[model samples]
Target chain A: MAGFFCLLLVLPLFIQGFYASLLTMTFIYIIAAIGVNILTGFTGLVTVGHGGFFAIGAYTTALMGKYLGVSMLPGLFAGGITAGVVGFLLGIIFLRLSGAFLAIGTLGFAFAIGSILNNWSIFEGREGISLPHNSIAGLKFGDVGLYYFCAITMIFLILFANSLIKSSVGRAFTAVRDSERAAESSGINLRFYKTLSFTISAALTGMAGALFAHHTNYVSSETFGDSWLSVDFLVAVVVGGQASLAGSILGGAFVVLLPYYLSEYRDFAFILKGVVLILVLLFAPAGLSDLLGRLYRKILGKIVRGQSDVSCNLRD
Target chain B: MFAQQLMSGIATGSLYALTAVAIVLIFRNTRTINLAQGDFSMVGAFMALVFFQVLHLSLILAFVATLISVIVLAVLVELLVMRKIRNADWLTLFTATLGVYYILHGVSGWIWGRDTKSFPNIFSVTPVSIGGMLISEAHVINILIAGGIGLLLFLFFKYTRAGIAMRAITDDVEAAQLMGIPVKFVVTLTWAVGGFLAAFAGMLLAPIIYVSPGMMDTVLIKGYVGAVFGGLYSIPGAIVGSLMIGIAENIAGGYLGAQYKVTIAFVMIVLILAFRPRGLMGGQARREV
Candidate 1:
């Protein structure tokens, strides 16, 4: 795992320009995917409106830095904080409903946010807003610098999520997901944990949006808060391994790079995405990470058995 | 002016009501909400275009063909895709429907292209003045057709054996199956009925909005809001709920701005889900836990 991350960190040094930017985008999505996993995988509550939170993060960052003239770091913090606060409130109302109803409600919430962004003059409506170049302490961060920054932040967030999942709160989230009644009987507060999961997930996703704003230097309701983007995020979380951090990274990479490779067939992309999602759900419901884990175990088992056979033959 | 708006609202509400009925039917029988409900209508509109505009078929023949094809498509989706994951959770089933949504949306775009095609009007384009209110012939035809379909459905449910079996399954799937109600067949029939209603609604709406892959998106969202607003489980409730939405949105668009019309549906959805989850005519809320 350490070696794999080292390879990722050094990847930008070997690949420059477009590929580097693409990798940067992948890193951003990886963060967002992990954020989604926390809510959907851990808490067992699917939200099709995380894109709304993502948009809030981006808009907050852009507005703060461009209009309010705040620094990049503060703007990013503000973005995450804003999205977290909103998620905390929305979660209270939305989490009351479960399953399909919740999914539809969140979907409506996303469209509502999109509608607000499109009509509100403060958001510049559909015209969108351009983000200023990010700088801190007299050091300007261009594409290369942004790539490094995103990679480091992604690594840190991954570690944070790893620790979080091992905590008691994480266990409560899993318990709720597995059986809400059982968890409730066992003294887990379903409402509180669910709300907390949403808040944390939104904050992480919002931070990713902040990075996206800085990287792209633009914010638009169509790009950020759209239903398609929400589906894309869900696709990433499901494809990677809903329950695993490693899965999220893999899923994010697949989502970002697959389209780049298949860019030649632009119109077929939607069909391909739909087909891929269906195939993944049917064949590997646990996701690609689980598949990889199984493969690893099989290989290790074969090697150990082969070694044991050789040793027995020599002794005989 | 007020009367004209009211008439138009009722006409549009009729369209939404049909779509809402389709949504409610699928939700009731399959225990799954088909998010692709609107996309099925989009497919129907394109099929109508192929039959009428391309092949030069009669309007009735074209409409029937569109309805049959959409019904086949819906059944195939249930049999091929949904059957495999029958035991999956609501989230999984919902996502599967979303997958269907994407496939239908993409295929329609591929076949019809991205540009909107002008759909031929089924009714005359002339307007008739009634007591100082001028209403288009299309609107009048739309209301009549919607009323006819609604009446037919009501009668079918009330009098038919298949309809009773469907009602049994919706009321209690396990009990219906144990009673030898042919639960699977009834469920498939429910999907067919949903497809029929969606296609009919699409045909009614095509003349006004034009035939495009993306045309039913707003209508679908509004239909969903209406369904939820009325009580997801009740057909009559869905109809009334959709009518209310139609009138409210038309008024909001006229008095406020047209841009805010879509937002009104979203706001209504949130409000309904928050305050009255069971909706106006829905039964008691059953907690999953």
Candidate 2:
């Protein structure tokens, strides 16, 4: 584990600047994917409107930096808090809605946000808002600096998710997901946990948005107005392996890097993503991580264990 | 002015109502909302363009051809993709449809390019005077056709064995299967019908909204809102709900500026759902063990 941590720490040093920054963007998406995994994967609620919360986060950070000259840290925090509060309120309203209704409600939320941002003049419409240079303690954030910042944030957030999932709260979330009535009968407060899940998920995505704004130094309607962004977030969670932290990492990298590599054929890229998503869901319902895990076990078992044991494990 | 907006709203509402009905039909049979429902219409509109413009077919022939092609596409979607995981959890089913949505969007963009193109209007744009209000001929035709289709569907649902089997399956899938209803066949039929209706709406809307890959997106959302507004299971409810949405949007646009109309409509949906969680006409929630 120490060695793994050391590798994570030193790995970016060897990569080119462009790739490092790309990886940083991947980290930001991974953060959002983790947020999505918690809500949709663990809690069994589907949100196709997370883009609204992300936009809120991005807009908050951009506005803060533009007007108040707030640094990166406070902007991130405020962005998260604002999104979390809005999510909490939405969760309250959504308590009675479930299944398809909730999905519609969330989609409506996204559309409402999109329209507001696109039409409202204070947001500067499509022109977008540019941030002042974000720095902390007189240390300016170059590409490397931003990369380290996002990486460190992701590590801490992952650790937090790991602990949260292992704790009693996580179990309650799972119970709620598996059977809402059963969870309620077992003395779990459905309202609290569901809202809490939404709050945490929205806050995490919000922070990702904040990081995104700082990374790009701009926030605009074009970036956050589309419902497609929400689809992409959900895709990342499912593609990565729903309900698994490791899957979020893999899923985030896949979603971000797939488009990057396919930049030459932009339209084909979408078709390819659709094909990949359908293939994964059809062949590997648990997602790419489960497929990768099985592959890893099979290869490792062949190398380290007797053939008989490997065959026996494979049978199960 | 109010009368004119109401007439126009009803015309657009009729299109939304059709899409909503398609949605309801699929949901009743499959228990999964087809996210690609709108794109089916998008493809249909493009097919109409080909048959009418490229192939130089007569208007009626082109219309018939477009509907048939769309129905086939929906059947293929069911057979190839949805059939494999018909009983999967909601998320899996939803994601699968999302995949189809992307494929349809990408394919249409590739085939047609991204530029918006005009659709040939079946009805001339000459304004007709009714009760001192000027309304376009297309609007009148759209309203009449939608009403006729709605009446036909009502009759079909009330009298047909296949439609009865669909409702039975919606009530209880296992019981319907036990009763020897060909569940899979019925589901496929429902998809075909859904595709037909979606295409019909697309063709009707093409003249108003123009033909493009994304033309059906907003309509889909609004159609969905209409479905939920009337209770997703009820056909009449979808019609009434969609008309309400159409009028509401037009009124909002006329009174509160055109730019914020969509926002107002969405806010109204949220408010309605908040107060009436099951929708105005939705059935009571059954307790699941």
Candidate 3:
């Protein structure tokens, strides 16, 4: 684990330019996927419209930079806060809707955000918003610097999320997801936990969006506000392994790197993503994390006992 | 001007009604909100292009071919994708449909490219004077066809065993199974009918809005809003709600800005879901807890 962390820290040194940007994006997506997992995976509330929060975050950062000359750190926090507030309100409004209605309602939210962003002159419409230069405390980050920033933030967020998942609050979220009625009967306060989970998820995704804007140095409705952006986040969460923090890393890497690997047949990548999502849901409901865990256990067991005794599903 | 907007709104609403009905049909029975519903219609519109424009088939032949192909696609989706995870949780089912959505979207974009292609006009574009108000003949045909389809569906549901089975399943899955209603067959039939309606709506909408992979995005949202507005389980409510949405949006566009028109659907969803959780045409309210 120590060696893995070290290698991750120095990964940006080996890769430059395009590969560096890709890695940064992978980190950003992992952050967003973690947020998605908290809501969809842990909290049991699926949001097909997380792209709206992401847009809110990205735009918040971009617009703040453009008008207020706000630096990277402050802009990111502001973005997260703004998105969190929106998520809270939206959570309350959508509290009544569950199942298919909730999914469709969230989908509409993304579309609404997209159209609003598209036509709103403040967003600059199709032209988009560009930052002057993303800097923290007057220290501008180049590709390598940005990559390191994203990596550090991702690591920090992961640790924070891991702890969050282990806490009573996290337990409450899972309880709610497992059975809302049971949770309520047990005095879990479905309203409070659900709204709280949504707020945190939105904030985390917003922060990632802020990072994305800074990394790319641009924000536009075409890229950020598109409904596809929301879908991509959900893809990351599912592909990574819903409800698992480590899965977010795997899912994020998969989402970001798949297109790069399939650059030759770019369109094939989209179909492949859809196929993979369906296949994952059908066969591996636990996602890649479960597969990886099994593989690791099998290998470790073979090495330790000179036999394969892996009989049980670890998740169950 | 007001009358013209109203006429056009009804025409558009009629199409939305089709999509909403398709959505409600699938939702009511299977309890899966197929995100790929709109994409099925997209496939239909594109297939129509293939038969009519590419293969030089006659218009009537193309329409029939497109509907049949879409129905086949819908059934295949039900059997292959939906059936495997038939008893999964709502989140899992929703994600599966989303997967289908992406696959269809990617495949269509891959084949047709990103360009919006104009569909062959099924009705005359020239405005017809009715009571000193000008409305496109295409709009008139659209409304008529939508109404006719609604009537047919009403008859089928009211009389046919299969349709009755679908309603039974929607009401109670276990009870329907106990009654030996061939629940699986009815589910597949629902999907077929859903695909048919979606494709029909797409063909109707094709001439008005040029066909593209993403063309159904807004329509799907509005149709969903309409479905929710007219109780998710009620077919007639879906039709009525969609028609109202179409007219309301058109009026909003004409009086307010076009931007408001796009925003109205989202607002309506929140308002409807907030105020009347069961929708305008009342059905059993979905309670999560």
Candidate 4:
């Protein structure tokens, strides 16, 4: 809810196309990161195939809009549902694998998705898909409007995620993440929770992908190629702070915005980005959120100290 | 076509095995899945590409130079970048490698453009046909070289003092350290060996695939699949896993359309891991003391 309000205030400022595109990318990433965090950070499962569901959402939307002349409303929802199903199927079948093994397995699925997108002549291969513009509820979206649409969607998802975390189900997920043996001993269904987290994460990521397809009005195999896209999500989730919704947004922004700033420096910037990721991982396992929390406490302490000193002096 | 593709798969599987073994080596020692390993391979192949021109050497000489360069590159990274943070948490090591992944990727891209370049053939040009299919000479040579290296590595690890020290470190890092067995040096050497193997895979692979900064990106996933399927900690497992992946990939490509090839490989990995997280060979769970 706070993030939605934050978006409401900030969406108006990104009137330009480039910044709007950046915001769109940011939310797309935020969706993926949050989805990933659900699996890796919250539930202790690793998946690299969110990109597959992401591609599923993208292609479903693009194909619907392109061929069926469907409205963005239906196309977007269809995209998310399609990806959700894929995630669900994979979860039922392969969620048994945890750790890096699962990570690579899921990535293989992404690779398969990429190849299908590439070789199927109907999908347009490397040339890419052009999409119809989206509008809803008496409003035709310009760059800024669509940016807010994405932002609004992202905020809703984040709040929903927060709510889920607070519920009994959230504790179940945390329990499973900490230890399957213990969770099983405590009467929790380990298989069910693990699979459910993977499914839920897939659905969330698929939703992001659907929004992305509509937002870009363009899609291609390259859009979800290799670990570049997955790595971006990983970097955002890590840099922003895992296990926190705020961290997802901040990480998305940091990963996206930092690049735009670095593009100014050209080639050297790539090296710097890599270095930054490495350094952050090595030194800040708790991520930027911990740093901010520390800073917030320090500022509060100083203010409290000053106010108390004044009151004591007056009393004296 | 079946025979040729089978031979080619076997040959490439050798390269896959080499890469996966390197991954197994590092994972064996540190338990860190070094994503940077592939990028290191890219660096080696790129170094071979650049130095090939400057050294004015034959393809064999270029391969040797590339191997040496990448080994140094690996060792240096281990000593400077990885060693400093050895005691960091797991996520820290994983994330640090992501940094290493990009740093090498960016540096390689900056030095060499994103364009794909071809390499000179390190071996012959004729096709060898045991049956009706055509097996290229390069495939034959690649298989030979990979097999020879695997044997040497196997022997070295089994027989040499340095190799036993290395194995001891993987068995118990702190115990080895207490035994005054130079654990840090072994780790760096492991990275160097990893870098060397990845470079070898790249150098051999350059002729087979195009050379680019991201050339090994997809292959890295395949290698990971192989390593995990074999058991991350098991060398023999990696070898078997790579060959299985190669054969499966070929069969899938033939039976299913090439479009579904990647999907097949991925589905197989996912299926196997889900059923057997310990891999085909199984891994022992050991807690650090």
User: DockQ: which candidate is best?
Assistant: 3
Candidate 2 DockQ vs. native = 0.66
In terms of lDDT, the poorest run of 10 residues in model 3 chain B is B280-289
Give the CAPRI rating of model 4. medium
Give the DockQ-based CAPRI class for model 3. medium
- Candidate 1: residue pairs that collide: none
lDDT, residue A129, candidate 2: 97
Instruction: Identify the superior model by DockQ, candidate 2 or candidate 3.
Output: 3
* lDDT over C-alpha atoms for residue B35 of model 4: 87
Give the better candidate number (1 or 2) by DockQ: 2
TM-score of each: 0.95, 0.96, 0.96, 0.92
Report how far residue A316 has shifted in candidate 4, in Å: 37
In Å, residue B51's CA in model 2 sits off its true spot by: 1.4
lDDT of each: 0.84, 0.87, 0.86, 0.78
lDDT of 4 at B88: 69
Error of 4 at A31 (Å): 2.5
CA-only RMSD, every prediction? 3.7, 2.3, 2.1, 4.0
Give a tens-digit lDDT track for model 2, residues B13-44. Answer: 88899999998788867877788999999999
- The CA lDDT at A152 in model 3 is 86
DockQ of each: 0.60, 0.66, 0.67, 0.64
